[model samples]
Target: MSSFRRHTCVAFTAAVLVIAHSAAPAMADDIPGKIAEASGILNDALDFSQPPVLPTIEAPRKTDIRASIDRGVAFLLADQNANGSWGSATRTKGLNIFAPVPGAHHAFRTATTSLCISALIELESGGLCQDVAAVAESIDKSEAWLTEHLPNLRRATSDAIYNVWGHGYSIQALVRMHGRHQADAAKQEQIVTLIKSQFDMLTRFESVDGGWGYYDFRYGGNQPTSSSISFVNGALLVAMAEARDIGVEPPKRVVDRAIAALRRQQKPDFSYLYGEYLQYQPMRGINRPGGSLGRTQCCNTALRYWGDLSITDNVAKNWLYRLYVRNGWLDIGRKRPIPHESWMQVAGYFYYFGHYYAALSMDQLPAADRAPYQSMLAKLMLDRQEADGSWWDYPLYDYHQPYGTGFALMTLKRCLPD
Candidate 1:
């Protein structure tokens, strides 16, 4: 084993020992059966007997990718709150423990900061960002804040509709942190402990149907029904798969059951359901308008990251790319403003998030298939970057810009050649 891997194992063990008492284990006795069933169904979903061969084409990088990444990092550093998180107190005010709202700035800080950290880590990992020392400092402060605030942020509110996004992103960032610190055994171990503890926390909160829900399903009367969101499940699965790849093994049953939940909800056309019953309905047609398009980008990207090459290949050729081709991703409402399809009003809500995930999907594709999408995404993103090295989809009282910048930087990192 690599020295870092060994350190990570130790860190996980140490973290489990330290935090085991505080965490409550999930009701997982029956999960194994669910896993078995889901596995059987997923096996039938694909003809894995002949997996497609991914060609080894070299990824072509846009000349400005590195500069764009650095500017994004600078934007994040400039906007970071004194508390080390990236949120505004005014927007986060009016917090009632039970009645949390998605627009609340506090509601997004941990996740946003986590995303920034993940982006910075990716730049550092790929050696794409020029300011190495500055990047390290930015990551340290943001990571410290996240680690400290995670417990409080994990608390449930009455309107916890978008909590899963935070949890999913949090794990993704933590896993990246663990992987990037491999050269420093001590730092890697410290991050591994955080990763393990958070994974355990996440496992305890897995929805009743073997997936995660937008709400904290454990309490708040939020029970996972047939109407769960595929985006949440996909995000959790990608996080779990990445964690496992980095040698921090979550409970096998938890990972298996989550994968099973995804298989059960996946549509034959490669488009995932917005909800359990609302399969293909696009985010179950949640509050945001034109959300189906946004959800498609995130869910498919997550699926692609977890080894669904078919989704990536098809998306580049005949799927969502077609939508982007005809109707620019800039604003869907400009072309068609159906009641729920008001892209202008709501596309801003998930604009950066969607593009970030979509870029991730392209990053995993074989070079030949990845080039065109990479070029397209790079141009679209570069065109939208603000003069201050920041990006924002919706200016919702001071929270969206930094978070959006975080998402954009992460996406741009993928555009750079490894």
Candidate 2:
């Protein structure tokens, strides 16, 4: 038997034994029938059939990678709005993600702008950017727009707290800004103040259940009553950790609760639930590995960053392997227009988002261990670059290309050799 089958069978046997052990003595005679039933359920849930083997793709040359990054940077520069930000309410399609007026757009624009700023900063810092002068100018304009507008960002409506994304991503951008202006003590102090204000916004908007969520369907009060979303928590936690690295400590209670909430959603295999609301239906497709292809990387990286010892090297590597092998699960949903309209209910937005976090997870590995995955990740990003030098998965108004390119650029940056 093949190694995949061998492992599956062993897992099946162990599962059956565990089930049989919990059976009552009176039902002992029905053990065989019970085992048959258990086998069926396990097979359906695990899908133990061997996946098709994809050919090994060699890493692209460094020159090729640099060229791609330059193209992506050009896309972001060209796509920037006159106000020095990225993304607007333009380019609406038949179906669009709900963004309630100025507030939602504020959050969307802030988050997208934050991502673009981060990408430019990272590439510039790495010395891979070709247009150094232009990049610096763009970063300055974006920093001005972000610091001015981000402070006013808030929930779009009672039910939509999309600003959480803005707060989380802005913290990340601010950290980069803080680092970039180290020589200018006054500028760094202002960035630090902005970062703390974002922290306050997060605390005010944190879900009553702990962590952050974009929706507060339950109560939508000043204290949001939304369920703690796994990926949202993951993103926020990672950003908070980055802030902490710069001596900006997040609220311990908030961090602890977010971590706890994330842990609650994490399955033994590391696949996370779509949100806390889906906890009851743990077996639902959206909560399974296929549905979770985009989430596990971010979630795992968050836990590891916050000192989750259980997320060892092997665990991180296994998820990375799953991400590469089952990348089609995410790929099939790309540019689908509608959200969660693909197989396994995979949403189009998760595509670049997943790969970005996967790149971050790759960073968790030792220097020597990252090369192969870096090559693999670079191949995936390079394969998907658009003729316009941008990468977009979902059609979210005019935000997709800029945000997607931002994520792709950052992901590709991690793919570069140290």
Best by TM-score: 2
Q: Compared to the true structure, candidate 1 yields what TM-score?
A: 0.72
- Structure candidate 2, residue pairs in collision: none
Candidate 2 Cα lDDT to native: 0.85
Where does candidate 1 clash, by residue pair?
Answer: 98-158, 273-280, 274-283, 274-284
After the best TM-score superposition of candidate 1, give how far the Cα of residue 276 lies from its true spot, in angstroms. 1.8
How much lDDT does each candidate structure score?
0.60, 0.85
TM-score for all models, in order of appearance: 0.72, 0.87
Candidate 1, position 225, lDDT: 38
Q: What is the lDDT for 397 in model 2? A: 85
lDDT of 2 at 14: 50
List, residue by residue over 83-179, the lDDT tens digit for candidate 2. Answer: 8999999999887677789889989999999999999999999898899999999999999999899889989899888999999999999999999
The best candidate by lDDT is 2
